[model samples]
Target: MNLTLASGAPRPSQTFRTVFPVLALCWLAVFFDGMDVNIYGAVMPHMLDDSGLGLTPASAGTIGSWTTFGMLIGALTAGNLTDWLGRRLMLVASVTLFSVGSAVCAVAGGVALFGFGRFVSGLGLGGLMPLCLAMVMEFAPPRRAALTTGLLMTSYHFGGMAATGLGLTLAQAAGWRWVFWAGVLPAVIAVPLLLKLLPESPGVLLARGEREKADAV
Candidate 1:
């Protein structure tokens, strides 16, 4: 039986109504960000085994730092641009940029190229979390906002686990490049829905003087 709370909200079974459509889309977007973050780690051993690439442990660490560095810059930059570009557009751009980076890594012929790809992917990965969290908080019912945020965050860990699973099962059989190629899947899966359904942040609209649009959103 459906249960009711003292505050008049339904129990867990009925909390689905508290979730907005954008929550699912943002969750998917964040999932890919996690996967892209870990894809290189998942396939690093295999990549290192190839003699032609000449990836020493020292160099690998440096390359890994590049990704992290890109993310640092991306987060700071995206944070400032949130007001100007709006959440939905920035989120789409972040996903698309990383997917393109993953594609570049998938086709790269050498260590330098792969490192560059990782850096590019990191840039997008960095910016997606704040955007996703902002959207989730904006849409969640006031009473359940905290729970919805926690749920959204779990998707990141799950995405990382999925990357590890893919590496264990398919990286060797399909090749390392295939692992990076898989990173592009999020753009294909999430971009269309986000473009069609995700709404801009009300705060952003109000800041830009679109009071009517902000109220409607």
Candidate 2:
């Protein structure tokens, strides 16, 4: 199917049709990303209360700083790496890395291990935001790019809400570990959908010298 704009150009309606699936996938992924990123914060109070974890307020602050530091490195590296690797691969890698980190957190026996897990997860979390934003912007109608970006960002808050809800309910009952387990669920749900539905950026395909694939999009 084709859609016509005011300029009388014959554009593919299906061009934007791909937008719904991709956007939904990106939204869910970002939502999970947000929940994972905030899970530590959401459960910090309980973590500190657990004497076995040996977490103090000062140590907690230090760990938070370390996670942020790791995120900075992740974002910078992923920006350059995305150019070399395709978006879909990077997205999958990011989701996988973060999910592993969440599992590590769920099973962590010491503060050191938990900190390390958060730092590792930070890398994936930091990398995902820009990539999703870029994809949404590129796929959206030119005039609606700003709106699309805004809409994409709302997923983060939704994820945060989910995290908050989980922290309130599960953290009190099953404990903080369960909250971390919840963080890992996104990887299970999102990675497969991304692999199946999210198409490679046409521009990226063209740049990689896959002209036919680019044009086929």
Expressed as tens digits, the lDDT of each residue in 1-217 for candidate 2 is 1346679785656556856677888898899988988888899989999999999999899889888987898899987888789888899989988999999989998999999999889999989998898878777777667887888899999988888888898999999999998878878899999999898887788889999987676
Listed in order, each prediction's TM-score against the native is 0.90, 0.94
Measured by lDDT, the strongest candidate is 2
> Please, what is the whole-model Cα lDDT of each candidate in the order they appear?
0.85, 0.86
Instruction: Point to the candidate with the largest TM-score.
Output: 2
**Pairs of residues at least 3 apart in sequence or in different chains that clash in candidate 1:** none
Colliding pairs, model 2 = none
Least accurate 10 contiguous residues by lDDT in model 2: 1-10
Tens digits of per-residue lDDT, candidate 1, 40-122, equal 88988988897878788988999999999999988989978887899889999999989999999998888899889889998
